[model samples]
Target: MSEPPPEPTSIGTWAKRYYYANRAAVEAVLRPHGLGSTQWAVLYELTTSGPTSQRDLGRVLHIERASLSGVVATLVRKGLVEQTPSETDQRQRLVMLTDAGRSVWKKLPDPFAEVRTVALEGVDAGEVATAIRVLERATAQVERHSFG
Candidate 1:
């Protein structure tokens, strides 16, 4: 009988490397702007999605509530973000981008686009689409199996 093909590499391994490499790039670019990658993502999300509950933001970003607490605290202290009680729920904390946050987001698209272009350069669109599909499906499966 023919042997089965060797097992493929796990996506988790590649994802770790991808995160590390991109984090490096983000640090180089954002250092002058006085921001970290997490801070940038928070600011960008608030800019695009308007205000959001801190819990909701953590869920959307797939971050732990404990980790996001520190991230949000840093942003708030930097004056890049402000937290208020949700109008609809007094117990929930809402975070909104400050003017400085908006300014940072507005200025980022160009440099971010540059990085994205480099990342996507020579990558087949079809392959990229398939990879995204596979990753999302894997994530959904994990969540369903683990949480539900």
Candidate 2:
């Protein structure tokens, strides 16, 4: 008989589980406002970062070009985002939130706080800090080697 496969590592399994769980919660919160997690992320970035180049946004968000294009198109159609040719580079597009977008962003409930509270219910502050540090290092390492 074939040998059984090795057990999955806790870190990878938990990371993926956490992502899906968090995504579901975020989706539930955003759906009523006609937004998906990806779309909300784009809007949130524009809100905090001011006008940003489309290429840069994709890079920062780790979004594929095709997916980003579709999301931007949908946001544009909804009148929540405006895209203009970059002043410095005509080939590049700059994306920013419209007044409507800002209004919606203002009205949307803070999604992360509730999720964080629930997820960290019994977790201590030091544990949280350690988790954050580990995740940050992992993120930096991933970014360093990432092609997208």
Candidate 3:
């Protein structure tokens, strides 16, 4: 009889697994704060970068166009974000973190640090650095592949 297909264990598979698992962990901790992972991700991006176009934010957050509306709506309900018309394009909107959003983000650093510390407790900093490098290269590859 032909052997069954070998189980997959490529870098991409492992990376995606880690991505989902990591987000699950974040969601578990963040949900109590009235935020989901995607919402936090949106806030994080806006906090790190400045106010940006909804399309650009969606692209960076990996949120599909159809779903981003709901995400923004939730944050708006929470009074954590604001959407204003883009200066250049009336058709486009820019999303900015409100004072409330910044407040939540500021508070998040401590819990997030604790989570990181727990998750990486056994892994050395060197390993973390290497893993980051690997992930960055993988991200660049994916971005190039997608855009090209």
lDDT of each: 0.84, 0.90, 0.85
Clashing residue pairs for model 2: none
Better by TM-score, candidate 3 or 1:
1
- Candidate number with greatest lDDT: 2
Residue-wise lDDT of candidate 3 within 30-136, one digit each (tens)? 87787887887888889989898999999987889879989998998999999999999999989999998898889874446657777789898998999899989
**Candidate 2 TM-score, true structure as reference:** 0.84
Clashes of each: 0, 0, 0
| Regions of candidate 3 where Cα sits further than 4 Å from its true position | 1-13, 110-113, 132-148
Candidate 2 per-residue C-alpha lDDT over 1-148 given as tens digits, one digit per residue, 9 for 90 to 100: 9986545766656788898998899888888989888898899899999999999999999999999999999999999999999999999999999999999899886666767788899999999999889988987898899585
Estimate the Cα RMSD of every predicted model relative to the unseen true structure.
5.2, 3.5, 3.9
Model 2 RMSD in Å is 3.5
Clashes of 1: 0
